[model samples]
Target: MAYYKEQFVFDDGKPIPIIIRNYMASDLEGMIELQAKCFPPPFPTDLWWNEKQLQNHVSLFPEGAICVEVEGEIVGSMTGLQVQFDPKNPMHTWEEITDNGYIWNHDPNGNTLYVVDICTSPLYRKLKLGQQMMQAMYQTVVALKLERLVGGGRMPGYHRFADEMTVEQYVQAVVKGDIHDPVVTFLLRCGRMPLALIENYLEDEESHNYALLMEWKNPFHR
Candidate 1:
């Protein structure tokens, strides 16, 4: 069943139907293609979701594994899992938390929703698909009555300023609007607040192996 649906009318003046729904076994191929298109050359193709991992996502946490579809094609996707979060110790590598993208450690009783990955197709970037996917996740958070939605956002734009400023400074700059980081800025626009800066979160050279811990608290949670 579809979790959410909307129609987007772009410059062409044609309404395009967009659906946010749970992942199905049939979506594996399209998802693999999306990963390649979203993260090209230097992104380590091995990091892409394999058939096994995608299968596990649907089997273990179908509610958390969703995709944005348009005319039967998967244009965007987001994957998440519930985890017992420790605010006191917010430092952890992505692999350690996401189980190297398999999300095999998902805890049904956990209090927080940890976003494993969220990406949009290059062709649909301007359609605000990412934001819509985030909104869908927000709905899931409220429905699940979780404490918050948390994730490590990569600083793909950091490589340019690595020689001039520390990761801390760069994050502050982005928060203050003094600098523009694609990932960090997008998270901020999505209503997420920066929790901390994590080191060795991932092996992305563009991000200098660093990631920004971000969160969006559930307003309805009591």
Candidate 2:
């Protein structure tokens, strides 16, 4: 996995102990269960029904994707695609490999790295596991030398799959309606500002039918 260090272990050394590692083919069932708990409108492996996507996920960001285990049992996992957007090299960004089933891709600038999806078992919430996974994601994106990123929160308007809500609803959800989700706050506290709302971007009847288009510069650029 270009996004993560293969065989890397994350040990907070707590009571249950956490083991983060590359996912295996046999772990699909476990992955499915975790997804249902993590995401509200969980796809649960039935919608995509593509084993190859998971395979590619493990391969793309070996260290980026993590299967959490406590007492030798797979309790949860987190994985997402890293679409490198090298603004200076448009062709390379377009040449990047992505499973045909995956809808994400790196934009031309290569400054952006989009997180297509992320999940962790509900039981693991409040353990900072989600933040940890996000940190790994930030590191992976920065490692690729990206200068920007784009993503959105979930919504209720669409009530579909991933696109389940309006852009504002998703943002409010992401921030817990507190005006500051750790992710958004962290990014902004470091010096980034959001840009726009991509209106009517999808035609899916079940989709929130819209997405937000936000970007950030190299806040820490020296």
Candidate whose TM-score is highest = 1
TM-score of each: 0.95, 0.58
Angstrom error at residue 40, model 2: 8.5
The ten-residue window of minimal lDDT in model 2 covers 89-98
How many backbone clashes can be found in candidate 2? 14
lDDT of 1 at 204: 86
Instruction: Compose the digit string of candidate 2's lDDT tens values, residues 1-222.
Output: 333332333446544456666677677767666655655564434554256666655555454456666566666565545555543433211113334425345233444665555555666655655555555556655665666654542223334324554446656565453443434454444333555544554333433445443444445544
lDDT, candidate 2, equals 0.50
Each model's lDDT = 0.91, 0.50
lDDT of 1: 0.91
Model 1 stretches astray by more than 4 angstroms: 9-14
Best by lDDT: 1
For model 1 the local lDDT of residue 2 reads 41
- Report the C-alpha displacement of residue 154, candidate 1, in angstroms: 0.5
**Residue 44 in model 2: shift from native, Å?**
7.4
